[model samples]
Target: MKLSTKELTESLRELILKGEFTSGEHMREIALAERFQVSRTPIRVALAANAKDGLLKYSRNRGYSVRSFDKRDIIDAFEMRSMLEGVASRVAAEQGMRLDAEQQARRACDVNDSLLLQNCEIDEASIEIWREQNQLFHSAILNQSGNRFMHEMMRIVQQIPAVYPPIIAPYRLQDLRLYNAQHRKILDCIIKRQGMRAEALMREHITGAGDIFCEAKPN
Candidate 1:
């Protein structure tokens, strides 16, 4: 099948974030071209795009390798994410309130809760649905922030594999429940018009994920 640069980039991003490519693993153009059933040109374009996003490292001799992060690097990434997400939540509560935005966020949270609150084992299929809902919830808050610069920078930050735990590692059901609980708390502050609490909770919520990622098996 033919894959455009955008499609190939997304595909490669998913593979890297899912730990298919271990940290510091070299991405051979010919090998990736065969894996994605595309040509080297598109693979090159995809790798270049990911490098721009800071997900991959480039060197003249080695070409492209998946970027590696140590414990400190992970902490720093979360530190930045926490601040940015907190600001977004605060701004949303302060100036971007709208009935429709609230409704969308509520629906996303409800969907995620329904999936995560269950007692049954979490399968890959359900996990995928929950991931989409989680993204929706986060995106709603960012979109309502009314700061284009923050939104764009946060977009780039989210692309970093370590900053996105769910995509980077398969999470336990219990972990999913805990994360969703935090999401609800953040939403609660937003609904109650408590900007400071919402901001603080969002910061705490994201840092908690960073802790979990640190404990998880290194990719």
Candidate 2:
């Protein structure tokens, strides 16, 4: 299928985060076009978009290459994201979530609950499904925050390596139910308008994920 520019960007970014492309490796438009089964135009635009997100470096003649980030860099970015997202949660709780946003979050949690019901075995397809729903839950909270700047900052921070929710593939094989539980608590806090508790829970949730990511990351 021909992917839109936004879809292409997201797909490429996810692959990059998953280590499909190594650090400092240059992405060739032709290769990506063939891989994604799309024309070079979308691939080109996607690469440029990722570059803007700081996931890739662009040079006049070098095109785009994956930017290398050590564990510290990733952890630091996640720290910032945690604080920003925590504030978002607090704001959303204080202001109250829209009916649609609350509904969307509940749906995402229910879908993930079903996914987590499987036995301890984890697969690529399952991970992909979980990632999608996880992103939906986070997006609902960010949107509900009613702060555009916070939302935009969360967007940029999440683009960092090992910081994006979809990058949780490394820890998925472990105790993902814990994360789901945290999600439920966060949702409950927002619904109950417990701003401080929601903020603290969100901070811990994000930092906990970061810790796991760093541990699993190769030295």
lDDT of each candidate versus the true structure: 0.81, 0.85
In model 2, state the lDDT of residue 51: 90
**Residue clash pairs of candidate 1:** none
Task: State model 1's lDDT.
Answer: 0.81
Q: What tens-digit string does per-residue lDDT give for candidate 1 at 75-149?
A: 777788899999889988877567888888889888978876775787778867887888888888888977889
- For model 2, how does the per-residue alpha-carbon lDDT over 1-219 read when each residue is reduced to its tens digit? 677888889999878877687788989999888899998888889999989888899989989998878788888888998998899899889999999999999999999888889647767788878888998999999988777888778777776754333465568555688898899999999999999999999999999988888887775
Listed in order, each prediction's TM-score against the native is 0.86, 0.86
Clashing residue pairs, backbone N/CA/C < 3 A, model 2: none
